[model samples]
Target: MSRSIDYGNLMHRAMRGLIQEVLADVADNGLPGNHHFFITFDTTHEDARLADWLRDRYPREMTVVLQHWFDNLVVGDDGFGISLNFGDSPERLFIPYDSILTFVDPSVEFGLRFETQDQESEAEDAEASPPLRARRDEPETEAEADAAGDEDEAQDAEVVQLDKFRK
Candidate 1:
């Protein structure tokens, strides 16, 4: 075995990149059809920013559905921002990608789970995107953001099983 290699970290980075690519595509064009995202993240993560009310509701982890109701979905180098409705009120959220735990596109049964520990402390690598900084004066309401797309036709997807990717 090559002691200098860190395949697990590389795999994690690659997986994150894939998610970013998908989100970037969605930003360009709205979710195609029948496709939506179920994203789970650490609600209490240092980089996560949510309305006080929402944070109080989900003190630890929370999953959000990116379907028909979200707006202002902006995918930045390090994180993403979106506006979700809370009892008819639109609340904005900013979540760093590092805080993400599970990302699933059920339409195709494609899912990825990331190991969350040490996520924030890890030094930035070439493969990772740069961090995003929020502008204090930016508008709260932005143009509606596009959703992730999915295919209407269902096809068998192969499952790749692996032990924990972290040592």
Candidate 2:
């Protein structure tokens, strides 16, 4: 049998949760002693933004290093905003949670592949989630589902954010 899901809005929120969790961790604990991030995002993706010159320069994907010199690591509900040095010139960027294509941290053997806003998030969600757990597809009680949903959201966030982006 075939079934369909409405992952359109869900994916974006899921993506947001992922970014929020990791960023919260970093903010709370201070990068975990050399655990930095190399996040590559779609420069032109709608919710994403970059210095005008930088955008003109790299229209597609740009990899940023989260190191000591970096500044302004702010995470919003929808995405993140930060500034990176692109050859001595500090460039500010706005990356929508949905526009992130890949997140990697070789330190922990971790990486995350963010589905494209249009067609990917749902695809990955269905592929990654185990069939057994979600098979029932029943309406869960508010209290039960609320607790479960929060946990599920966290796990889902971890799976998607801390996944292998290239491999």
Q: Point out the worst 10-residue segment of candidate 1 by lDDT.
A: 133-142
Clashes of each: 1, 1
What pairs collide in candidate 2? 111-163
Candidate 1 C-alpha lDDT tens digits along 1-167: 55687666677777778778898888789787988887889998899999988889999988888888988989998888989887899989998887887777767666676755354345254334223211122211113112222322124558876765656
lDDT, model 1, position 125 = 42
lDDT against the true structure, per candidate, is: 0.72, 0.64
TM-score of each: 0.67, 0.61
lDDT of 2 by residue, 1-167 (tens): 99788664565466558667998667566687767776778887877877778787777877776767667778777777877787888878777776776666656646565555344456466665421121122222336546665454323433466466767
What's model 1's lDDT at 104? 75
Q: What is the lDDT of candidate 2?
A: 0.64
